[model samples]
Target: MDEVQVVVAHSERATLRVGDVFLKVDADQARIDIEVEAMALAPVPTPEVLWRKPPVLAIAAVPGTTLGRLGGPSTGSPAAWAAAGAAIRKLHDAPLPRLSGRAGRDVDALAVELDAECEVLVASGLLPAELVTRNRQVAEAALRPWAPAFTHGDLQIAHVFVDGDEVTGVIDWSEAGRGDALYDLATFTLGHEEHLDDVLAGYGSDADVDPEVIHAWWSLRSLLAVRWLTEHGFDPFLPGCEVDVLRSRM
Candidate 1:
């Protein structure tokens, strides 16, 4: 029998891997429902659903290694990164899902939340006030209206898989739905600024690609993530992580 490997575990959810099968255990049934639904609706490759029993959903692992992980060096070549970008473009061009996703939140509401979080970060001394203030200013550029696209709300680098220069699949669709296209682009390239051009090269020219907005998202995501990450026992201050990404903007 294959040993169970803990993929990730936190208060909200846990994922376990046994051989080729992965079991996702989430307390929120709605999130599970969304993950299942989003995977079904997505045009891109996704993990095969093996089974589901209430809080635990099982899936077959996709082929290939992840493109990379945040705070670490990427083993994937530039072509692989571009292929991942092409796959993302395909996903963005797909039809919108029925449900609203995390990335699809109202801009005004998100701005309000961001402002509140910024205030907390400063008052709590979680981040330097100057850093917070500068990032907040940069973040304002992303608060404007945007055309919705089928987005992978949390397109972290680790979620994308590639075999050589071919993108095999994308995973973790719980946050998938209609949202800003650049948001997904920004999320994928976050903390890996060196590959932004390679990704954009394959993302194509027709899509509205704005460097300023992408930079704003880098700062905004880092600022908003600091508190939650710290509380969740994640060290965002590590070299080449969220804090470094924020600092790059200064």
Candidate 2:
């Protein structure tokens, strides 16, 4: 393996190499005969697989730093945000092989889980039926074609690999699917409302994404989710329960 010494120490997950195929971890989903696809990297915290070209692609992980994010979004100028958005535009339209399939997601399992949660909420009268309805509407709108273009299913910032001021590449190809590119773009721009124009300008595509649907899912996650969690007495410190459970489609 070619050693690219870019850090002082390496984490268990960090391995230095140049163009060598990484061996999948034993029992890891990456090990199975499944493909990984490109998706818009969102702001959520999840393990992602980022790629870099040459020169600066090499990395040496600092020991004990693996548990957190690498270099994250810039709090500086909107220009940096603009750069990220532009990079995402390039990534969305790029063509490659389909990397994943929705085999593991169990429809019955999700129904059971959601039903139980809804029941508990109803039992306590903490459930806002309107919020649930809103959430459903949001999900439904985001569930389909926003326009004819490539889409990154799980568009978030964490999947974006930022080097210096530029997003070199994006990681995590798990939820990539063929659908409206706007859905993914909307997800990317939701939290960063201020730079919405920069994001739109970056998305140099003729296709259009449903703004209402984007607004709907945005509402579902930002409003209904908070309301539900507060009513259910769910603590952010608690284990097993993740915000992703509520916004799984994102």
Candidate 3:
């Protein structure tokens, strides 16, 4: 019998690993629907669906290890990171999906939400006012208009898998949809600023990505994430994590 391994668990969803299969248990069927549909439409490689039983959706694990975690060092070489960037570029250039992705939220709406979160962070003393304010100012650069692209939405470093400079697959399609391509880039490179050049090199010069905008997104994402992460029992304050990312901007 294969030992069950807990991948991640929280109030909303949980993922468990048993041998080569991963079981994702999510309460919201709509999210599950989105994940299934997104994977089918994505041009990039995704996990193979093994089975689906309501809240429990089983998928075959993709080959290769992830790029890295937020607060951890990445073992992938520059070529591997570049390969992941190329994969992302392919996904962004693909035809848009019907569903709006997590990154597809309206700019005005996102700004309002960001402001509210910032206030909460300050009032609750969760973060220093100067830190929140500085990052908020920096985050403003990302609020401007951008053409929509098929985005991974939550393109965390851990979501991209590579095998020796070749992208094997990308996982977690729940937030995949049409949105700003830079958001995905920023999310992937967040807290790993040293690798930004390598990633961009593979993303291509034709990508028209703005480094300042990507930096803004780093601040915006970190500020907005702190509260939710705390509520969910996640520590965003870990060294080289969200708080560190914010501080670096100052």
Give the candidate number with the greatest lDDT. 3
**Per-model RMSD to reference:** 1.3, 9.5, 1.3
Model 3's number of clashes is 0
Can you write out model 3's per-residue Cα lDDT over 111-202, one digit (the tens) per residue? 99999999999999999999999999999999998999989889999999888999998899898788899999999999999999999989
The TM-scores, one per candidate, come to 0.97, 0.52, 0.98
Which ranges in model 1 have alpha carbons more than 4 Å from their true place? 100-103
Q: Looking at candidate 3, what is the lDDT of residue 18?
A: 98
Of the candidates numbered 2 and 3, which has the greater lDDT value?
3
Ranking the candidates on TM-score from highest down gives 3, 1, 2
Global lDDT scores for all candidate models: 0.90, 0.44, 0.92
Q: List the residue pairs that clash in candidate 3.
A: none
Question: Each model's number of backbone clashes?
Answer: 0, 11, 0
Query: What does candidate 2's lDDT look like per residue over 1-250, in tens digits?
Result: 5654322222212323344333222223442223232322332222333443321122222111111121223253455556666766665566633444543223355445554555555566654565454455555554443334344555655445444445545543445545555556655655544556766655554535446666555543343344454645544223312233334333
Model 1 clashing-pair count: 0
Give the lDDT ranking, best first: 3, 1, 2
User: For this target, which candidate reaches the highest TM-score against the unseen true structure?
Assistant: 3
lDDT of 3 at 35: 90
Cand. 2 TM to true fold: 0.52
How many Å off is the CA of 37 in candidate 3?
Answer: 0.7
Candidate 1 is scored at a TM of 0.97
